[model samples]
Each structure stands twice: as C-alpha cells, then as structure tokens.
Target chain A: MPQTADTNRRVVLSERPNGLPDAKTLQLEHSEVPTPGADQVLLRTRYLSLDPYMRGRMNDAKSYAEPVKLGEVMTGQVVAEVMQSNCEGYAPGDHVLAGSGWQDYALSDGTDLRNLGQTPQNPSWYLGILGMPAYTAYAGLLEIGAPQPGETVVVAAASGPVGATVGQIAKIKGCRVVGIAGGPEKCAHVVENLGFDACLDHKSETFAADLKAACPQGVDIYFENVGGKVLYAVLPLLNAFARMPVCGVVSWYNLSGLPDGPDFGPAIMGTILRMKVKVQGFIIYDSFPPSLFKDFIRDMTGWLESGEVTYKEQVIDGLEHAPAALNDLLLGNSFGKMVVKVG
Target chain B: MPQTADTNRRVVLSERPNGLPDAKTLQLEHSEVPTPGADQVLLRTRYLSLDPYMRGRMNDAKSYAEPVKLGEVMTGQVVAEVMQSNCEGYAPGDHVLAGSGWQDYALSDGTDLRNLGQTPQNPSWYLGILGMPAYTAYAGLLEIGAPQPGETVVVAAASGPVGATVGQIAKIKGCRVVGIAGGPEKCAHVVENLGFDACLDHKSETFAADLKAACPQGVDIYFENVGGKVLYAVLPLLNAFARMPVCGVVSWYNLSGLPDGPDFGPAIMGTILRMKVKVQGFIIYDSFPPSLFKDFIRDMTGWLESGEVTYKEQVIDGLEHAPAALNDLLLGNSFGKMVVKVG
Candidate 1:
C-alpha cells in the first residue's frame, strides 16, 4: 500500500464525532499529487504537530477558528520541506513551518508559511517548543498571568508542552511553581526535571488537600488548560487578586451538553467578585503581538541551550497513526508533546 | 421619635441573613454622642449611600473586605458636615466625604475623610456621581472593558449609578453602547437620558431577541454587573476576543445557594476558550491605581459640566428607611442611586 510517485496521501474528515473522536472520524485518501501553480509551492510535510486544539476544530461548532469541512484534509501545523516552488521567495529543499495539515503533500501560495531556512537544529522543534505551544505559554503567562516574584503559579497538564514551558518560565522568573498532572510518574518528572517546586497528582483522592498543602500561600496565578474537577479544585485555592489565564479546557471538549449537577455558575461568579480575580481566556495568536515573538524566540532559545528548559516529545511514526495518536492525547495517555513523523 | 441632642441614632447589623436582609437583620440603636478626641473631628451625617454591595457585607462570608460586625453601625459612605474638630486640617461647618456608616453622628480621626470645604454645591454628589460608584464605572470600563470606538459595549442595571456612569463614559469614548434594564421606563431613561445607542428590557419575553437585534455587530465588551439571565443571554452573543469586565453580580446577591439545574460551568469555560474572550472580575479600589483618581476626577468633572453625563437619585428621607431602601435597591425597584437624607 505504498504511495506512488504521482500520488499524495492525506487524512480527511470523514464524519463529525458526537463527543470524543474515534477511528471512524477520519479516513485516509490517495489522490494525484497537486502541481505547483504560479505563485504556489509544493510542500512535503516532515512532521505534523498534533494538539488538543485540534479536537475543537473537529466539531462543526462556532469557535475562534473555522471547523474543518467534511471530506477536507484535517487542518494542522507542519514542519515541511519545499518540493517544488513557483513562488519567488521559496525554493526547492528549503524547510518551512506551514499549515500543511494532516497530509503527505500540500500546495501553498507561500502566504502563511514561515521559512525555517535550509536546515534547522531540529525541524520538529519548530512544531513544538519553538512554535505555537511555546508562544502560547509565553504570551498567556507573561501577558495575562503576569506572575511576580514570591507568587505561586499553578498549571495543569504539567508534562505537556504548554504547561511544562509555563511552569519552567515561572520558575525562571523567581516564583513558586506547582504543576498538576494525572499520574505519579508525570508528577515526579514535573518536579524533578521541569524544576517545578511541587507537582500534585490530580488522580489521587486527596488531590485537593495535596494542592492546598503544597501551595501554602494559595495560588496567585493559575495557567488553566484543563477544566472540570481540576478547575473546581483550583477555584477554592485561588487567592484574592489571582489571575487565571485560560488558554484551553481540554477536559470539557468532549461534553455533549451541560453536566448534571447544581449549577456552579453562581459560585464561580461569586469567587471572581469576592476574590477580585482576573480570569481571561485567550488564544495565543489573538493575544500575542507579532513583535513579541522575536523576544520569545531569543529567550526560549537561550533557555533551551542553557538546559533551563527541557522538552519531551512522543513521536508517533507515520501520518497514518495520527487518528489514534490524537485520541491518545485527548485521553491523557500521551506523555509529552505529541508529534507525528510524517516524512 | 426625635433624636435628643446627646444621643446618636444608628443602625447596627443584628444578625446575618441567610438569603436576603429583612427587618430583623438590622437593629436601630441609640448611643451617647462621642466627643472628638485629639486629632479627631465630630461629624453630623447629611447623606448615606445605599448600594447592592452592602448586601455582601451583611454575610459572614470571606470577601475582599470584612463583614459588618454584629451590633456595629452598618458600613457605608456618607456626605457629612463637621460639627467640631481637634484635628489641624478640619474646622466646624466643613463638608467631607467619609465612611461614616448608617448613623446620625460619628467621630472620625480625620484619617480617611476627603474634605469638601464649606457649603459645596450638591455635597451629596460625592456619594454618587463624584464617588465610589462613578469610580467603579470609570476604572472597570476604561481599564478592563477597554471598549474601542465602533465597538458595541453592553451593560446591565442600565439606570443605576455604576451602569449609568459606564454607559455615558462608553458613549464619550465613541462606542455604540447597549444597555439592559429591568423595565421599559428604565430602558427609556437609559437611551434618551443617558445617551445609550439602544436599551433592551430584560423583563420582556423577547429580551434575548431584542438584545440580538440591538447588537447587530455582536457584543465586543460586556460590562457585567447583573449576572444571572442577562449574563446567560450575553454569553452566546459575545464576539471573538470580547472583553467582560465583571464588576458585580447583584442579581445573584440574594440567592441562598447555587441555582438548581445542569451545571453551565463547563459550557462557560468552553465558550471562553472557543471565543477567546477575556472575563476579568474586579473591585473598583482594588484594581485602580491611586494615581488614576486625580485624572478620573478631572475628566468626570468635565463630563458632568458639559452635560455629557446625567444621574438620578431615589433619596429616602430618614435613617430608619436605610434597610428598606437597600432592599428596594437589590430588588431593582429603586430608580437610580439609593440614598438616605439623614440630616
């Protein structure tokens, strides 16, 4: 079942899922390789970055970005190499960061592609630490959370790219960083490797008490990514004048409708008012001024080189494994930054 | 009964209310009028401001400020005239804005009083248009809501002091302001008198539809004060990157506990993430820098003098009417700023 020279392989949206996505949601299809039109470039994807945000794009619901249409190639960011170029600035063999999606090859007009040049230290790194997730961690934390020295910063999904980066950055800024992860192993890694002051396993029955004990001063800034029980636990622990930069709520992505219970809306509102907390939701690109990205790159690169910031990648080989990998990511089974090695 | 010259009439917190304050919550008492000590001033109250936030201070719950103690004069801001002074800066007959609470007479150490000097025009104006409520509206709208010109800014409790001030300021900033009020009369006042672009009656069955029709561009900034059904309706209409400066939730102030229903917390979190909205809750003084107050006073005074802002007051005649006036304010029966003429 190897692809022919004239053919391109892609994963397309087969059907929309009701709650969690399954294997049947996406289908692999083969078509004649698209030719580069005038002012267009042919891109061969080397790595496809799989993120929790993709779960949102799968639904035909209104969001900051449009949902992927059924029978269309699944949208994603990819580290790709230019195969053929009809665009003036792009040339064959040049590496780039582009929204080539879940595909073997894509036709781009070079409008949105970022040239990574002929060779990058690690091309796939551009898809994770040097790309959107890192930028998200930087912008959301520094701009919204605005953690100060002696403040306690808490983040969920501690081993994941965004949370790991956020916790480390907080540590670098002379703050107490506590991470919330799902298992003991992840928790240990978060504290031991990521330099977090403490890491609490949210799976434990005493998770709330553990978090309270760990953050003696109460949480000043909560980098909210996972919402549900974690959010509920974080709510009471949030100190007066706390800042919650909500970049994602991956846990609630699969919910069909409102959960069955006494509404917590009033309590949430009450906490917000009584504590004078600032809970701001933002997408990285929406909030980040393009000028800040240059600073982000310089600082992040230095941190990476100094070993102050470490990143882990769960590389699932082949584009065909993307569906199962994405499902694993949503299930909290993926250990780190989940990226598909497409080429 | 007429108060004797030697006795001071005061309202005290008799007990904490479970849901809403009633007749038994506050007890009227009389005490000997205290003589001013060294560096102190004796004051006779002229006006007492009644606000919905006082309802929160009645509860034995943790909040930004401490609850009113049992059998202590109920906390409030007042416009008062100095009767005697041992303090260097004060003199008899001087008007001042002070936290004198619900009482006919008080002795201040001249610490927190803002001297208004002798017979200033409308001294009670400091308790409404020139004071805390106006400051709340100014700081929250300009600092948090940050409404830009051509953007649609929505606010609730449209004719009340804070809401009225917020709408007028938004209008001054060239934003298209839409107000949500309880009745047609209040809505009419909001649009015609307060200079809002449109005002919707929340009591109408087609309220949500009316809001939609009025906000054709969708809501860009929601100055959240009334946070029950009004908030629910506004949630769906919030545009991408919308800013919600949550200054109050007066509608839920009287609830004994959480409302019974399927939990909308997850839905709120989801909407926040998908729409990339910014929801920041703040208390006026807590969020505003002290330096901003001078600028606020200068600009607000200009606005008032130019007829760019107008205000209304529902003034009760006596100190004994304070509790009922507060209840009326919370119940949305009070037309505008609720105050007690205590002199």
Candidate 2:
C-alpha cells in the first residue's frame, strides 16, 4: 500500500540559547511526517503548551528528564488527535494527551498518551489545569507543605498555571494565600480571580516589604516556582517550620553563569536551621507517585466541574508564533498558560 | 553542712575571642562562693564535662539558650555532690547533674540539676553518654537522621562524646560507619576501640581525598557536629536524599564573627535542592518530649553495662585550670570530654 508523503511542520532548536532564547534559536521546518507503526498512533497536534519547564528542556542540564537535543524539535505537552492508530482504545480522530512538542503533527508510540473521548470539556485544559502543571501545584502544596487553616501560603509566579492553581488550592484549604507576580494587573487577577487573600508585585521597589506586610502571620508554605529575589524576600520572614516545595527557578533560567553577588547558601542553611524549615525540590514527575494520577484526575476534574478551581489560558495562534510566545513566557510576560494553537 | 570555702576560683570572659579563644580572652579569678538559700542547695562540683556546645554559649548571639554573660561563670555540665540541700530529692552526699559551671563551689536553687542515684554506673558516664551531650547525639541522630541498616553514617570529631555515640548507634543499626577525627591516634582509637568501619584523620594532607575514598558508598547520614572546611569538603560527596542533623558548629563557634571569604549559602541550598538532601538543625531540649527519657536511660545504661560502648574522659585537675582548658577545647586539642575537677 503506497502512502502520501508525510506533511508535518516542526520548530527545531537551531542553536543553544546565549542568555534568553531569541527567535534565532529556533527554525521552522517542513518535513515528511512520521508514520505510526504497529502499536503506535499518528497524532495531529491540536494545542502545544509553552511552559516555563520548556526552558529547562532547552538547556542540557540535569533535571528529571534529559534535555532536548540540539537540532531536535523542542519538547512540551500537547493535546492532539489520533489520525490513525494500531494501539488499543484509540481510533481515528480520537483526541488524546501527548508529548508532541513544537510540531503540527507527531507520532506517539502510545507510551504516555491518554484518550479523550468525543464531546470533550475544554480540550486544551488537558494541556494545563488537568495535566502536569496543575498536578505539580496540588501535590507539592498539599502533600509537602501541608498548610493548615489560616496559615499563610505564598506562591511566586502567582498568575501562571502552577502558581495560580497553588494559590487557589491554598485558599480552598482555608489558608490565607499571598501571591507574588511581576505586575499589579496579574497580582489583582490573582487576588480577584484565584481567591488569593493578597497579592504582591514582585517588580515593585517595596516588594519585600509588601510581602512581609501581607504575611502578617509569617509564611508557613512557600510554593517556590520563581526562585531568585522572590526567594531572597521570602527568606527573612519565614516562620519556624516553614515548608518550601521548590519546583522551578524560572527567574534564573536564562543565566549563562553565576550571578554578580555573594552566594547566600550558608545563610540560607542557617535560616533553615534557625527556622527548622523544609525546602524540597521536585519535578512533577517525582513530586507525586504515579499511583496518585487517577485520584488526582478524579479530584481535580471534580474541582473543575464544581467551578472551585478555574483556569486561564493565553493562546497564541500558529506554530510560527511558538518561539516568541515561549520567549515571552520565560520572561514572565504571559499571564497564564501559553499555548500555541497548531491545528 | 558547708561547701569547701568558695575559693573564689572562677573562669570568666576577659574578652571575646576571634577564631579561637586565647588566654587574653578569658581569666581565672579566685572569688568567695555564696551561701545557699532556704530553697537552694550548695553543690561542690566533683566532675565538670567540657562540651563543644559551650563554644556557642560563649557567643552573644541568640540560640536555644541565652549566651553566657561576660565575666559570669562559664557554662558547663557538672556532676556534683550536694554539700547542703534545703530542697527535696537533693540531700548531702547525693550526686546530681547541675550547671555548676567552671567554679570551685556554687550555690544553686536546683534550677537545672537532675540528681543521680548513689549506686552509679560510672557517674561521669552521666555527662558523656547519659547526660546532655549523649542526648544531643541520640535525639539528633535518631530523630533527624533516621539511619536505616546498611546506610553509611559519617561523623566528624568522631572520638568526642557525641560523635562516638552517633557512630556506635549507627553500627548497632547495622550501618557502616566512617569516623573523621583530628589525628591518626584518635582515628585509630575510633576504629579499633569504637569498632567503626573506618576512620579518617581530617588533619591529614589527603584528608578530603581520603574521606572520599573511605566513604566509597557516600555519606547517607552526615552528623554535622563541626562546620567550616569539613562542611565544604562533605557537600560534594553527599548522596541524594542524605540527612544532616546539625547539633553544633564547633568549627565556627570560636570565631568572633562569620567565617571570611566566599559565602556558599545559595550553592548549599542548590545542592540541597538538586540532591533532595534534608539538612536540619536541632536542639535536643526541644526534641525530648519527656516520655522518651526513661527509654533513653534504660537503653544507654544497658549499652554501657554490656560494654558495647566505651567512653573516655580528659580530666584537668582543679577549677583554676578551666580558662586554659576551655581555650584548648575550643581549639579541638582535647581528645575526649574535657572535664575540670572543681573540688
């Protein structure tokens, strides 16, 4: 049986980034689409998530997974359609969760793709709130931080997918949620929409003071996604027994080398000792045991269904815009989940 | 009953020390001892245990307890016989654990004294294994470190009381123990008499490299009793998810201020995050919930009785020698518990 030529366009990393990745770091290429073999499925990328985690994938550093190799398509989560499949439970046109990266089309071995039946509830939600970022917030905040009612939970990058979810969950747990975002608009949205008790503008000169005032009772849990000055500010005001579950250090992602300042490692450990604080670093993959996936989906699906947890998405139309959108996302310019619409 | 006249012999701070205490920083003065009140007891110090923790008390910084007042009696763990007692449970001839300090005799209201029975299992053992130093090692190593069998436990200042006890307990739990001490003699004593798997002399020219070789399995539980260079050396070799129970910083305690040169606080926290290590600073006074004391004593007494553990004491005769002895103790010159017999 003869088959038509593969029709797929992918954005590949043309070069490793210098400081912040520019459009020059990526190249949009049209190539023959890969055919799904037996036990594999042909996926048409529907929504490609541009996340802060992709920054880690861009660099060849030690992380939960290997970094995306140079000249390869950038790696990310995607919502896609199964055009053809030899895998069980997935048929033609059936929507699924996939890691199709920066492409218009991809082929999955059916290893980690989950089916989404017809009549879906926010199909792109599977790329975000119903997926990895949301789960990162849930597991790290609840399981590790273990915040109590009235305890203050402070989350940096407060308006993004992970931080927004973390803040809302903390609020839902009856904790006073203080969110820190880069600007007043995002901070307001965090407080108004996400139900955060207070929100601080990290870009403001009085950011540290404002954070201190907002957390009158001192912070009990700091869900650390942006770990730079935000961490520096959080350091002094941490009450004894504070729990810090560190997922990402987005603030320092673009750095090619060490910053221009004295290293604060000893003082941080001293504060950790003086306060008996626990700072745990985990990727979502390591944060939760795999067995908790079903429970997470069940609980989170209910929360979304009940409207207790709401999500926001900043969609950039076209795969051609992904590189720029991701660059902006890395710089904290995006207000929520940055998804590139491919199909 | 009266104390042998307050010889007025006392070790008082003459000046604060920088790096290490010298004779210029401390002075011995003969002063008259005060009389006991109706609610107090007159204690004639029989055995004074010079502990590393006293180094921290010599500093003016806030800690688990108040710093020793300048010109006041130096704080220490003393095993004394009651010369006179108006209080119950403590009578003439009864041995007691008291903060009798570095003095010829002291008047007490029985504030920080716990009386030991006359039928003693080596009364000085109270200061080493059954008293504050022992409890510090036990609570920190057991509660904080939580070493499992076959895990490798590394302790610095290994021939000292706390480190020795930590090594023995790690061995009893069936873990391989690597002891780091000051000299070849102490290291030999640690391995042969204490039955550690291996002992490394930290003062050796190949100290860091030798430690790396000796700890081929890497350090699973690093009982951080000393800080400074030892900490710098251990940081890289820490296994993922290693536990560091920091009880004291004898290495930095004698310093008048923070250690000089490059600050590595962020690097340390980064190591902690990337390695998922748990470095907790603890004070035993906070750990003992009172219910565990009886169990601790029973087990320790049994261990001592069965000759499973050996304790060493370096007794300096007379109260007048305390100032010089304290200087030497802070400099890591003492081989074991440095006790001044203040009879």
Which candidate has the highest lDDT of all? 1
DockQ of 2: 0.35
What ranges in model 1 sit over 4 Å off? A1-6
Q: Native-contact fraction for each model?
A: 0.75, 0.26
Leading candidate by DockQ = 1
lDDT (Cα, tens digit) per residue for candidate 2, span A259-340: 6545455456555666667777766676467877777788888888898898999998888888888889989999898887
| Candidate DockQ scores, in order | 0.72, 0.35
Model 2 misplaced stretches (Cα beyond 4 Å):
A1-6, A12-19, A22-28, A58-62, A255-261, A291-295, A302-308, B1-4, B7-32, B58-62, B69-73, B100-111, B201-209, B254-263
Model 2 score (lDDT)? 0.80
| lDDT by residue (tens digit), candidate 1, B65-91 | 999999889999999899999998999
Error of 1 at A91 (Å): 3.5
TM-score of 2: 0.88
Q: What is the TM-score of chain B in candidate 2?
A: 0.93
Residue B229 CA error for candidate 1 (Å)?
A: 1.0
